[model samples]
Target chain A: MAHIVFEQVTKQYDNGFVAVKDLNLEIGDDEFLVLVGPSGCGKTTSLRMLAGLESISRGSLYIDGQRVNEKSPRERDIAMVFQSYALYPHMSVFENMAFGLQLQGTAKPEIQQRVQAAAAQLGIEELLDRKPKQLSGGQRQRVAVGRAIVRDPSAFLMDEPLSNLDAKLRVQARAELTKLHKKLGTTFIYVTHDQVEAMTMGSRIAVMNQGILQQVDTPQNLYEHPNNMFVAGFMGSPAMNFFEATLTQTGEQMVIDAGALQLPVPEEVRSRYQSLLGTPLIFGIRPENIYNPEFAPPGINPVAIEATVSVVEMMGHEEIVYFALGDGHEFLARVDPRSRFTPGESVSVSFDMNRFHLFDKASEHVLVS
Target chain B: MQDASNIMRLLGAIAAIIVGSGGIIALFYVANLVVNRLPPRPRSQILPWVYMVPALVMLGAFLVLPTLRTILLSFMDRRSQGWVGLDNYIFAFTNADMLIAFRNNVLWLVLVTGVSVGLGLVIAVLVDRVKYEPLAKALIFLPMAISFVGASVIWRFMYAYQPPGTDQIGLLNAIAVALGYEPIGWLVNKSVNNFALIAIMIWLQTGFAMVLLSSAVKGIPKDVIEAARIDGASEFQIFWRITIPMISSTIVVVSTTIIVLVLKVFDIVFVMTGGNLDTDVIASRMIKEMFNFRNFGRGSAIAVVLLLAVIPVMVTNIRRFQQQEANR
Candidate 1:
């Protein structure tokens, strides 16, 4: 319903501890934007400041083109689902959802109608008479969402609403929440420390670390085109392998001179990175990009490197082959399920240089996004 | 003679209750007849109060009648022959000994309630999850098992003082002597003795406050408070609007309980100081005026004043209980 804009927003505590710093993000209207990071990464602080729960120490926040820096939370017309679900323990589930509407002085009949409708929508019609203590955790979370939905706010601010649920329930609730967001068509700003949740839920994720914004991009873009070393290493499982290598001009092509092996820079990106020739850079590649020479994709322009397989994790669909080059830097390659490579076996692993990632040695900033 | 009158009063009270119930049933029948003029549902609401007539009548006899009689007696002459109007009240408030009693009662009310509740809250918050929390709480709560008269008697010996040159017999004075200080007279010193008695009340009542408030404090989940903050409640707003409302019944129960007990405080003062050397309080003063001096008018006035002081707190406690029931 509303596009949220954070223009250099900073949240510094009164004790001079900065929770969030110089955040500049534009969340599109009706977008499910997830702010994901480790604990103390300021994702929750950013969400809190957006909800007007915490004050923005600097900069401004615009919701639907209105600067809401000085507005109280009630004045901002946003509904929030807390990690604890924050139901009025004294009230019945019906009254718990009706509370905000009641506080706004909505008519009793209208409040009842909306609450009943929301409860029915959430499949909690039977729970309407129950107090929060009488319900299970998943039911409480559903009621929390139902409470937010009943108000029909301009946006929904969720601060780790699913983290308290058990793993299976969290997964089920994640899909339910996505469906709810689509049904409401309201902007959903969710904050969490779970990367998997962020990847599964967010239309666009803003990754933060130590009070600093690291990257803001789609899940696919974040995995494919990380803007810095931190983002590249943080997004993928079995994370991208890195090596300290220098770029060199070799007979009409550019290649990285690793200590004991030479990795060719792909022709498509060689010219683009020619200016950094002979300069030290970090060579990076995803585990999925490396394949056994025999199992390499038909047209991937694979560069073969001889390495000994140190470990092989057979994942049914594919094999995760842990191998090491002569210089002793270990790497993981996701090869075909049919691969017969075993530990201590020398195999030719193919690097798909088309998906190569590079970062500046000193700055750790990505050479290409 | 006292036992004979007590039995006679018991027979009189039974006869009054029988007559009272009959009168209440008659009153309710008439009220029901009048309310029957209204619509059925509205009459239904009003009819419940008709069912309460028995209770109201009993309250009128046992509570309201005695309160009215006390007020009436507060204005009468000592011999119950002529009206003295405000003379008894004036004497109750203006007399030197009576003023000292009022001052001492005020000191008891302020210090006893504040220290007990304050220390109770501190201990409750700090003792949770400690290694021997139940043992510690039980130890602190043990004083409540002792009757006020017994507690005062025990504390009286503890506060016993001797001259500096003599070996101290009391625990406090003995400690002082061992610590190489002069053995000060704890009970004989007016200011010190009043506080000494006040400390016993605090020691006795703090357990009551702790047992109730601690449970209330424990009932508040951390996440709920966080939710309030996110729900737009400021820290102060959360404390005042949410936290206070959630535990208000407990707070009211504890406060009014201690307030009512302080209003009628007599046993401790009588046992420890015998209403002497600036230790006189309203209830003790009333008893002394009525018995030792045989000044019934002044004593009735003091009793009336104490009843007046306790009424609001009692009403508040009843209201809190009613509100809690309403919520349920």
Candidate 2:
């Protein structure tokens, strides 16, 4: 087991295109740290670098407090599972799992025993003799994991290992991977572009964008308190909506001038910016934080605003109502299924002021991180 | 009576070849059985090499030992007694007749090997996804089925020349006359005769190259290529480190095949040009020295040079094949 640390690690291609930049992350031993981003966001590059597969263009990487910039993948004692599984086409499943051990010069009988043990753990003992082409996507994925497990390496690096499987199989594999991580008790640096996978599997998720590290935090922390406009917009489905407005401090109330609507800021947030008035700022609120005014529970003071319902999607348990604000800016509100809302109808919505995010217009950094 | 005697000679030659080949194979099989019967029972991998003993032995007897003897004999006089030093080699390099043969062989090697492999690669890539590829490949490959002598005879008729006027009997001169040009002797022109000879070689070897390279290209998987890069391989490293190793056996097979074939090629040049008018290759020159001029020293000297040239390429090919098999 190893604790991996990336101290300002960066990956830059020969053409001066930086895939990752100034990434400082510490993954503790036995911790599952996921690197998540969209395509071309350097998640896989970071993972491959950790696996000693890509050279660090700048900065240093440490595994268990030992600098390993010059170490090869074999010397690093790490096992990797590629997105396609990358099983040697000529080898049987058993041979595929035994290849690393054989390369390491592990004894023949021991290689077979470890391979069989891994295969049995994966419920693929009968598949040992079959080639990768004969197996289904999930089966191939398990073989890839088994190949890593058989190595008993210091860490396991997986690059979107479940992406090839179908939706149902992906869910099943995701659960199995989490269980595997716990059982092995080895550090796993998983890379994927799926936010759901990062949130569900990673004990800590590191969000990245355009070669820059955005945030490294727990899923609940990322959802509740985002650090910037990008993080606030990227964390949740339906995305957080942003509107340009100016904060104005009146005698006792801080009212937001949102073009055609005026909403009061909660007193606690108002006190933080009482001295600064008439400054333009970006207001962000998650879809779930806004509710149908009629169904919004009584007890706390709510900021009421009017909007024209554009579309209503019934999602079994809740209805996501897309609405256009008076100034033509659009956003969504997740309302109770019992609420009666339809397209082309104007409805009053209440923003949960306590749950909204505020950001500076110029810097785009969250004002309340 | 002469015909009966000739038939008997022919039968004897055929029988000798059959018995020689069968005896070598049986000898290797018995050796393999003996090795299998020995103690310390876990060396099964020696079995393949044991099976390889027949080919190795044949190569040693007919090719390697003869090459070594020729190199040794190249330093001696025709009687194989006096030390001639580099006399035969000097005659080979400086003599105008031998120089012409040397230049012609160079032309044949460059044109035949280069063009055959280049054109074969192009054709293989083009027909890779075509619907009637196998039919096209088979049709193109038909030349290989005909012996080089047979092909030379066929193309000889195609290039058959006649006198300027009286009925151009040859197909080429007939076409020339039809196209309103004077009849021309195709093989008599020193400037173009080498090319004409080289064309027959390229035609016969291109199909072999195409079949081997095509299969090698198809065997490479995209996943393995990407995995190679992900496993710390750069572009050139990926090419040399993974791609080459994967397809190396095919490359060595095709290249050595063409190289060895070209080194000893004589049937086409002998049949078509009779090794005259700048069309004489090393093989033809060697035969002319040994059989026609009765200069065994010169012929063996040329044979030694050819063998030496081919040995390096064969050694490199053997090493690559060994590496590939080891990885497997």
Predicted complexes: DockQ each: 0.18, 0.12
In model 2, the fraction of reference contacts reproduced equals: 0.17
Q: Cα lDDT of model 1 overall?
A: 0.86
Candidate 2 per-residue C-alpha lDDT over A1-369 given as tens digits, one digit per residue, 9 for 90 to 100: 998899999999999999999889999999998888889888888988887778999999999899999887666878888898987666688977876776667899999899999999999999999988799988999998898899898898989998989999999899999999999999998999888899899999899988889999988898788899988888788789888888887789888777876878877777787654777788888898888877787765678888999999999799999999878889988899998688999878888887777788898988864
Count of residue pairs whose backbone atoms collide, per candidate: 0, 0
Which regions in candidate 2 have their CA more than 4 angstroms from the true location?
A297-301, B1-328
In model 1, how large is the Cα lDDT of residue B315? 93
DockQ-derived CAPRI band for the predicted complex in model 2: incorrect
The sequence of per-residue lDDT tens digits that candidate 2 reaches over residues B42-121 is 54767777778767887999988987788888888876788899999998888888888888877877888888877776
Q: Please provide, for model 1 over A1-369, each residue's C-alpha lDDT reduced to its tens digit, 9 standing for 90 to 100.
A: 988899999999878999999999999889999998889999999998988878899999998899999988877888889898888787789977877776677899999999999999999999999999899999999999988889898899999999899999999999998898888888999998888888999999999998999999999898789999888887877788888988899688678888866887777777798788877899898898998777677878688889999999999988888998888988888889999789999878888877888899999999864
True contacts kept of 1: 0.25
Against the hidden reference, what TM-scores do the models get? Answer: 0.64, 0.61
In model 2, which residue pairs have backbone atoms overlapping below 3 Å? none
Question: Residue B291 error for model 2, in Å?
Answer: 19
* Worst 10-residue lDDT window, candidate 1 chain A: A95-104
Cα deviation in Å at residue A267, candidate 2?
2.2
